[model samples]
Target: MSGKKCKHCGSSEIEVDPARGDAVCTNCGSVLEDNIIVSEVEFQENAHGGSSAIGQFVSAESKGGASGFGRAYVGIGQESREVTLRKAREGITALCQQLRLNQQCIDIACNFFKMALSRHLTIGRPANLTQAACVYMTCRTEGTAHLLIDISDALQICCYQLGRIYFKLSRKLCINIPPTGKCFFLYHKVANERAAT
Candidate 1:
C-alpha cells in the first residue's frame, strides 16, 4: 500500500490478491510477488468500553441511572450506590430550601427516603417526584403543614397523581403518620398521634 511499484512498467498501482497469494499491478497487469503472508496483531481487551483503537474508556450519566442520585437502585455497583445516596440527600436539601422547611422537617423526610426506596416506591416513577413526595409527606407529618395541591404546585405536578404516589409510598412504608394544621381539618382526620409526635 505504501508506494509499491511494479518493475515492468514502473507503475505504483498494485493490488493484493490474497486467495492467489500474488500482488498484481493494476496498471500493467504484472505480478510483483509470487507469494505473500498476511500478518495480524495479538492481544485484545476492554470489550464494549466505547473508546478508540488505542485504549478503552467508559463514561457514566452525571445525574440519573447507576452513576448518581435520582436513580432507583435496581442493582448496581457500590460506587454508584454511594453516589445515588449522596445525590438523594442533596436533592432533599434543595427541596427543603425551596419549600422553606426547617432542619427537623428535612431530617424527617430524609429518614423516610431509604424506607421508600427499599420498598421500590420509585421503580416506575421519576426520582425527583418521589423526593418531592417525601418532602410533602414530612410537611404533613410535622406541623409545617401543606396541602397536596400546594405540594403539587411547588413540585409542578398534578395534584391527583402526587396524592396517589404519596398514598402508595405511605402504605408501602407502613407509616401511619397524622396530618396537621389546616390540611387535617379539611378532608382526612389525623390518622395517628403517636407517629406524628
Candidate 2:
C-alpha cells in the first residue's frame, strides 16, 4: 500500500498479506512476518505507536477483564523494571544455544524475524490465535516438547484450525515447520478420543 521496497533484498514488489498481516516483497521473496503476533505482549509499543497501555488495556480487559489486566501489567511492568536489551540478549543467547543457532548473530536476527512475523501474521486479525499457531509451528519445527492443546488453548483456537493455519503460514513465510516433539502428544490424544468412540 505504501509502495515500499523490500527490507531484506531491496526489491520493489511489496504488498500486504492478509493471512500473515505483513508487508511482503513478492519479488525477492522476503516474508517480513514480524508484526503478526505482537499483541501477545499486550503492553509493547513501537516507535510509531498503535500499541499502548490504554489501548491494549481496553482490548485486553474486554477479552478477560482483570485477568487480562494482570497479564498486561505483568508484561509491561516487567519490561519497565528490567535492564532492557542486556537481559534480553542474555536470554536470546540461551535460546540460541538451545536451538543450535549462532549465538553471535542470531539474537538480532531472531528479534527482527519474530517482530516481522508478529506484524505481518496478525494484520487485519482479531486474536492472538495466529500467534499461537505460529508458536505451535515453531515448537514443532524446533522439536520442542510443548503440547498442541497447550498451544491451541492458550491461543484460544481449535487444534484443527491451528494446524491448518500453521501450514498455511509456513508456506507464506517460506519457512518449514516440522511437527514438534509434542506432535506425538496430539496424536496420542486423538487416539484416546477415537478409542472412547
**TM-score to native of every candidate shown:** 0.52, 0.34
Most accurate candidate by lDDT: 1
TM-score of 1: 0.52
lDDT of 2 at 9: 88
Q: Write the per-residue lDDT of candidate 2 for residues 114-163, one digit (tens) a residue.
A: 65344465345433445455454555565555565666655446888767
Local distance difference test, candidate 2: 0.51
- Error (Å) of candidate 1 at residue 136 is 1.6
Residue range 39-131, candidate 1, lDDT tens digits: 432233457864322211112533322222222233323455455566778888887887788888888888788778666677788777787
Residue-pair clashes, model 1: 0
Please list the residue runs of candidate 1 whose C-alpha ends up more than 4 Å from where it truly belongs after superposition: 1-78, 179-197
The residue ranges of model 2 lying beyond 4 angstroms of the native Cα positions read 1-119, 179-183, 186-197
